[model samples]
Target: MKLDVELPNPQNLTEEFEWTFPVGTVNENGDAVITSTDKSPAKVKFKDVIGSQRVTLKTKLGGRTLQESVFNVQVAYNKEVKTVYFAAKGGNIMAVKVDKNKTPEMTIKPYDMGVKSGQHPFNIFFNDSSLYVLDCGRQFTYINDETTQNMGDGKISVISYDGKKVETMLTNVGGYAFYDPFYGYLNAAEKKLYFSDRVSGFAAISLDARNQTMSRSNFPYFVQSNRLGYYGKTMMYTSLNSAFEFVDGTWWWAKINSPTGVFRFTNADILSKEATAADPEPAAGVVFKNLVIKSFVVDVNAALVHVVENSSNALYSVPLDDTILKAIAKVDDIKTYKIADLPIKAEGTSAEPVSITQLILDKETGYVYFGLCSDDETLYKSGLYQYDPVTKTLTPIVEGMGVYGVAINNAKSKLF
Candidate 1:
């Protein structure tokens, strides 16, 4: 079908037209398709793209869009859009459809999105219909080997909302990706991404540019082990399993081997000092100790931090307030969910172990989603599940699949 829009006023009869539509609404070949000025009445011949797509038509003069020309057009489709995306083996990103009225369905064989070889697409973030994937490439394959060439070959890539465009923002990226994707965290407030890399203890990537050209040189180190005010000065490098930056600008992190607690630090207290070796940060402190947090997400509204404890292999809600956390609240008092009752192997397999990664929050619904790897069955079967913290209800969505990374498209605070 062709969508045509005639010039309303027709002031400049010879003026050209620019067409802007949803990612899928105007795809041409394969995936790289957007923006066109080819037809007379600002016409667009739709292809496989079908949906209630919002189409915008702009009239151009002198090769530029007219003052304020914007149009709205909606095309209906057969099914609701996809909501859940995860990376399985082979570096392919698959999609799972979760509609209110329909049964959950997932793509088979070939995936919806593709990434480069040797990548473990662990974390996927959705903002403004785009996905930011953190691929811990070769980080695990050569684990424990300091001389491995590709040990620091991880990367970060961005994909179009429709899974058409895949672009890598950086390479040679290293992270503490053991079995889960909690190797890094994104802070929408500051428009920056913080992740633990092998090269730097903790590096921050600024998302100001459409595409960043940050090499190991432009390393935005957040909390270097050697930085003046940093706490863990004795360690040469860090293997961060869980990390988060609160809206208040406080940084929180927990290492892979650390069963003590989550460490906390402020930017001003750590960055002001020059980075050296074996020098501890005087201001560094542990917010909450004795809880080995494997993977976690913050529920700002509830003021709780839901974490998957490594030792117990259970889900628990802890007070989000750092002030109260430091006051020595007993870990047993907080509520614990039932989903983590299974044996999730966050370790290597006999020859190669499976990583039971994924703990995310759908803020809009106040529900938390997570993944479990098991050979057993239950009301909440293996795969991925959605938990409602309010009513303590657990609904299993995707079952029987080895889920590597799970990212929901429920990002209310989008930076893009």
Candidate 2:
């Protein structure tokens, strides 16, 4: 069998080709025969090869071989096991191949999927072969113009792992008035996406539909219909600060204002056709009277929930008991347990404490990663850190970039 290879030559320079074959398949001179036709396309001829085989072709330009352009031809068995995808605040989605020993190998970029810059991908959820991206659009300028007022007209989109296709599942959503979509959860079982909007409220969208618009009434709230106006009475919780999936498939969300505490709601409660005020209030517990929760993650294996206090950078965890996890209870029914305070100062300086913006737990590795950023004009302490709950030790991973979110592919032992 013969295979023709065309190496890209933007400069149109003359190139030499070297071909390598599987062991025991070479000619008597121990070299694979490669021929060039008219100093252009190179051809490799294979003789008496049986099962599967691999051939590699290398091109030399100016007597120097091009390392990156080496092409490999596989007879049959070519497969990829795992992939990791993550997004940044400035609307960049990156895909990487998991490499255990070293840093991940980045495979695709934003441009490859037709995603323009400045889209502000706040959070991402990955299933088997696709990534669910929450694009919060550009920050809202509040300029009273249509474009500015609708700056945060966000959407939930899904991009193929290979970056070959993109589909918008929902669009023209609210929630960019204050900040990016703060938290997002994908209920794969129910084919729904639940997200928190600082300005609008907590809402869920059915992934089964395309380009669906979510209104404030589509959320789960504790308020009444008289206050909701023409939207009608719906279960919409506007005070939600953050939310996480519980062990039993329900959801727990933290509130930002009065009755400040975490609340739990089930799929049944959200899907129920009830009035806004008549709708069951989120089963509340673990209340923090005056503290604002920035983010949280559920450690299912440990039966614990780690919460981050937005202002003080204080870490707290509460047990997943009936008081907090199963049924609704009063603030006094559950207690807030203090965990180790996150390290907010620079390595050797007594700088102002950096604020923690996000948190994620790798249940497999027992490592909790958080992102930090400072507001002081004179001090800028921003980076990613790993916290070991067992040792109560916090270690800095890398500094400078204000990492707002982190995700982990536990099956592949990869973090992003």
For this target, which candidate reaches the highest lDDT against the unseen true structure? 1
In candidate 2, position 187 carries an lDDT of 74
Global lDDT scores for all candidate models: 0.55, 0.50
Error of 1 at 169 (Å): 1.2
Tens digit per residue, CA lDDT, model 2, 1-416? 45455667798777777656554344444465543323333334334332224456676876777873333332211223234344533434543333223323322111112343235454667765666777655542222334543445667777765556788776654533533344577777878777765534455777656655544544444322123221132213334355455447565655554334455555444432333544344443243444556577878788766777654556767675555544324333233466655544332111211135457777775667665543431443455556777776666554444445555444442212
- Top candidate, metric TM-score: 1
Please write out the lDDT profile of model 1 over residues 122-233, one tens digit for every residue. 5666666666777666444326644443335567777776666877666553423332122567666667767665323667776544455444467656666555344444
Question: TM-score, each model?
Answer: 0.64, 0.57
The C-alpha stretches of model 2 lying farther than 4 A from their native spots are 1-84, 95-120, 140-151, 173-182, 208-240, 244-249, 257-259, 267-286, 317-357, 374-381, 396-400, 413-416
Each prediction's RMSD to truth: 12.3, 10.1
Model 1 Cα RMSD, Å?
Answer: 12.3
